[model samples]
Target: MKINSFLLILLFILMSSVTSSSQAKEKAKHVIFIGLDGWGAYSVPKADMPVVKQMMADGCYTLKKRTALPSSSAINWASMFMGAGPELHGYTQWGSRTPELPSRVVNEHGIFPTIFQLLRDARPEAEIGCLYEWDGIKYLVDTLALNHHALSPDYTEKPEVLCRMAESYIKEKKPTLLAVCFDNPDHVGHGAGHDTPAYYAKLKELDTYIGRIVSAVEEAGMLKQTIFIITSDHGGINKGHGGITMQEMETPFIIFGKNIKSGGEFSESMMQYDVASTIASIFGLKQPQVWIGRPMKQVFK
Candidate 1:
């Protein structure tokens, strides 16, 4: 009787462990961060971005104002991914003159470890990938030793190409984190103001690309397990960023997908760094100590 009771107890313990492990796996969350290089909050309503508009309506959005120092792409993107200010990241502008080199040089090295690096270390089992037009993010990914795939510098891609790449990564690697940066609207807006017909057309093109990604996720059957976050680095000035104007500083923040409460907007003041922190929280990882921004917990519902 004693031997039989001991065997039954062992079996019960093994079953309990298996059940707990399966439950933990079921609760795992995946994140896809979509970056619109130069989108601004003020332009979102007017811009004909149907998919993004629908996401805003169906999920949580924040008119949460943004301010970027040196508002340049290199600086803002570094700040956003590193979750630290320029002072910490040491990426003040697009170009940093190194006294060691006689000629002017661009500073490609960011000072702090990026959120990607932290995630890679904390969650090695999680697959990760990044598609970005800027070299700054690539530098961060390389420095952090994170797993990622970058887009070409020319920012040229057929809809099919982008879709195929994303689909293959999700299907083959099953990455828990995916980051994509689209630069069309930003480039067009810089050449032409947001009100221009060209800018509106670019917005529509961006929406179509976004729709493709959404469809791909749905088809992959990962839609319910994924969290989609769409945001921008900084807005543009009259035709460019790196300025103090509201048009150049304020941007949009939208979140959709599993576990997210629908239909709400946050008008409170927020910064770009919030993106990294929020993503960290979604993965059940502790925010990096160097991260300065607070996680916008209200958006998670």
Candidate 2:
């Protein structure tokens, strides 16, 4: 009788462990990260972005999310994907195709470890895709880790075409991770100025593209299993960024769909590097010790 009771107790402990593991598993099967270049948080109030505004109303969002210092494109983009700041990842300049300084730790790929490489390592068969309007973005991600990647031949002029390509990719591949980067807003910001009418107008146009992408996800039948993360690298001033001003520092971070908390305005501080860690959390992958970013698990259900 004593041996039987001990066996039953062991069975109960095993069952409990299994249940706990099941409960702790991640809910999202796909994460679509949308990055808008030069999109500043300060412009949210006056800008006419109905689709993104609806996402903010229905999802977790914070307008106070900050970018890494210098607030330039390549530096912050590197931070957003590499899960560390310039001082650590070593991509410090505005259009850094390669690390300006030696990386603290580089993966076998010779570049600093990025979220894409982490996901690829954890899930070998997972589909990872990236479509970017700016050619510079290609240099930031691990192309060897991605299953599909494209650069817009039109450069930053047309975002709608990029959205169409994304739509097709979503329906066909049903990617585990997809990053769609639009550069038109930043292009307009540099040309006509950041706070000008053209910038807001470009945002409104981009909102339609965003809506279209969301619809495409639904059409591909991944909405219930997918999460949408909309964010930006930096905001700009009159016609430029890479400064200390709030407009150049603060950007919006929005997370929606698939077991995420609704209408959550996270007061907890978020930074650019946190985006990569959050993506890692969605995949149930452990972050490297070198990564300083923390997952916003507060937004998860």
Candidate 3:
């Protein structure tokens, strides 16, 4: 009888340990970051962006009420990646001029270590991939040395190429951290203006692209282990950003995935830098001391 009791206790202890380890592994979540360039809150109510709307309905969302300096792509993208403002990352505009250096874009130096670099340092086994417009990822990861792949240079053909590349990466690479950027809305908004038919068409195309990404993840059986975040770098007004207007500054923060609470919007004003900090926190990474923003803790349930 004593031997039987001892064996039962040992079994219980082993089961408990296994359960605890499974929970820990679940906590080690994967993240998919989608950056919609020139996407504004205005577009949300107007466009038939079903995927994004569904994400908002099923996940925690916050009104990202903030503005980017110079309202340029490079500056804001760097801020979002580094979790630091222009002052810290040292890229304040799309075209920046340093004394003694000719007027050049942010991609010229490409020396700063991005969030991916930090992730690599903390968890060397973690797989990371980036598909973006312009030099956002390159500047962040210092692609000059890392040999990181980008979609293409021409804006006209980039989105389609990006979709194909992302599909291939997700299927083959199974990255722990993946970031995809869509620039259609931003391009059309600049050329045709917001709320126009052209802008709406661009948004619809972008939504279709988003659906494809989600479908690929689901097919790979990674949906349950993935945390998806959809947001914009900054909004625009009259073909420009940087202005403090609500349409230009106030973006959306939509998050959905396993182990996340759903069905609510956060009213608190959050900055762009908070995105980087939140991502870092999600992976148990140390937030940069220089980052002034805090993680959106409300999303995790």
Candidate 4:
């Protein structure tokens, strides 16, 4: 009886070790796409964005990514969502003219497939969510596809509220993909130039939200396999975008997560369209043949 008990104990130890190791190898189960509407690419290294820097410590980063032509918020966000530019996605109008929220978008026109539509069609059971601050979101995606869609006030004064809702939902739902759109930086950037002190301060505040969301992911035990793609639709030029100037068009892409090349900078060219394409490719979702955007191969480990 003593010998039998010893053998059983050894078997249990072996099984426990094997299970722990298996969990360690498990990849991230979801993708967290943190899209900062007007997040300036230049700040990735220049500004004191601790959260962005911490992510860079384990991800492939680039400071020179580009947004689509017309460099406006509405048009580029469409490109970021559908992996196509304005000419292809058909979003000509965007952003606020005065300080009010923009009108709802109509997708009744013949629009190309978006990440949301493809995900719903391909993985119907998989849950997805988005917390945004802008009304242009109506034009950026197919509303029916999102299982949890939350928005802040239309005045762009509620990023903290948006983040809190997203963080709580992520902890509870653990969706396959969650895009948290923080607009306060863009709001601050437009009023005060991109290089101004206030702009950096807003970025620091944004970093806190990023940290909270990451912590929430960690608590959910999905941090290891969760892929984080941090990017922006456009930067700022003086107080506005929608121009050909590099400041308005230039943006950044910091992709940090499981299966991604960690602790390195990618020299490969990247852009807003690539952002959508990468999300599709990361999850083995084959891009449609007609899609022009291609995933950045260098992002993979």
Candidate 5:
């Protein structure tokens, strides 16, 4: 009987350890999610994005992260934010301002529940904002949930201006969550063709923008308390996405700062919806029952 008791105690201790390791030691005070529209994992090898490369080295990353079917902007963006694919969230088209199909569920805000909505509902005082070059992002993120939301004048002509605005917002508000979405890469991809010189040049430019945002966070004395996530809506082919090609479906997902594993590469399969779930986990917020995303908890140390 004593032997059985001892064995049971050992099993309990093992289970406790597993549970502890699965959870973050401390919840993040700030999470910066940077979305690069149409940046493909295939271009990572050839692009001169030193800032992004450094992020990959410093954090847990996966080049194999996948977008939802019909790899396009609005559909995958909804998946990333809503924590479910088109069938569930119902934002099925390339640039859908509203759901092409009926959403399975919605929150008090009267739209699909997004990470922003989740945070707002749970922590009413938490500062949440988003700055994007794409106007369509407003519809996806549920602007009513955000404390602040802005659309850049023109991404292709003045990308730096958007970055500066993001920097200023970070330094001033010290937001609990901030999403900076760049539409330049996708515009360039469609205009000059994906995997071309212009596409790479555009990516390089956006990398500088990311660097500026990181600096702004550090300048605000929130560096140690902040987590950074970089990902994309979809990739592209010759001139467009919305297809099943590897280039269109595969995008890089990088998570760095504050309790993340250093130089770790996530080998597990991850979906676009998982990004929202991961953010929810970092904030220690309970995910809505409608969300199908599973957090990439292995990224935490």
Candidate 6:
């Protein structure tokens, strides 16, 4: 345990030093990570996703990004949140139950601290918010303590409400971080078939909400200082996942912000853990020593 803490401290110091020297220009004040659950890589064609296309055109993106193994929500999301694979985070099952963590580890006594836990620990006064349609993510060990959070059975009908709340929070509290998850596409994909019209329609509908919220951010004049990181936990089969098929493994990763470089190569491979690392990089947070992935520097200015 002593070794773990020492390593983390050393890593934090080194990363902070680099960040201060190399990444000090145009540091972001807010970061919004939008996870479109089960969003397939091929499903985001320009014809169907105008808003997404606009965002991609304004940022760098990869439609070939791969998620973690097993393709399960609990596993992939856990990996994304804690920047650890299933072997480290110990959450390989489904359902809304707290994760089983190691008996001992670093970071405020939490074995594998989620970004939410780390942010709250580091900055208690800084506001943070999250809205998720997948309830399973609500139970990650120390995730229950975020400044603002909301979960629904699914994102079918009432997701707009979550968006409204997120917009309100952005305008009212100006949270340091606001994460939102849309689960309706995955829900409809499972029942109707990932390639079916219903699934595509659901994604399009969700895209409209995305445009609305982003417009809210723009209207609030936060976009110039805010970073937008978008991706998915995993893709799905016609309506199911948890398999290793290409459809179930591939997802799209996008990064857009004033400081981020635009129209860059989108061919670099990325993993689910890189999502959190990239966000950490944007906010100048020291990438945790336990996280194996690094920021996609190709996306930064």
* Cα lDDT computed for each candidate against the true fold: 0.71, 0.92, 0.73, 0.77, 0.92, 0.76
Model 3: residue 37 alpha-carbon error in angstroms: 1.1
Candidate 1 residue-wise lDDT, 1-301, digit = tens: 9999999999999999998865553323678888878887778778788888888888888865585686667667766776766766666765332112221222233336666776777777777888766555665443444566866444554533554566667766666888887765677777876557877777788788788888878777888888888888777756777788778888888998887878678766678777777787777667656668777777765
Identify the superior model by lDDT, candidate 3 or candidate 5: 5
State how far residue 206 of model 5 sits from its true place (Å). Answer: 0.8
Which of the predicted structures, 4 or 6, would earn the higher lDDT when compared with the native?
4
Write model 4 residue lDDT over 226-266, tens digit each, in one string. Answer: 99888888888678777888877788788888888775778
Tens digits of per-residue lDDT for model 5, 133-172 = 9999999999999999999896666768789999999999
Task: Estimate candidate 5's alpha-carbon lDDT, on a 0 to 1 scale.
Answer: 0.92
Our model 5 lands, by Cα RMSD against the true structure, at: 4.8
Which residue pairs collide in model 6, if any?
190-239, 194-238
Residue-by-residue lDDT tens digits, candidate 3, 1-301? 9999999999999999999865654443678898888888767888888888888889888766475666656667766776777776677766442212322223234444456766777776777878876554555544433224575467685557777777778888777888888776788888988778888888888888888998888877799888888888778887777677888877888888876788668776778878887787778677656666677777777
For 1-301, candidate 6 gives per-residue lDDT tens digits of 9999999999999999988886584368888888888888878773277887778988899988787877868778777877777767677665526455452244564546677776676678878888787776676535554777877543455657767866787888777888887776778777888878888887888888788878878877787888887788888887798898988898888878868788744777788877777777776677667777667877877
Q: How should the candidates be ordered by lDDT, best one leading? A: 2, 5, 4, 6, 3, 1
Question: How big is the positional error of residue 202 in model 4, measured in Å on the Cα after superposition?
Answer: 0.3
Candidate with more favorable, higher lDDT: 2 or 4: 2
Q: Worst ten-residue run, lDDT, model 1?
A: 97-106
Model 2 alpha-carbon drift over 4 Å, by segment: 1-13, 19-23, 155-157
> TM-scores for all candidates?
0.82, 0.95, 0.84, 0.84, 0.91, 0.86
Where is model 4 more than 4 Å wrong at Cα? 1-27, 96-111, 154-158
The candidate, 1 or 2, that scores higher on lDDT is: 2
Candidate 3, which segments miss by more than 4 Å at Cα? 1-28, 95-113, 144-148, 153-158
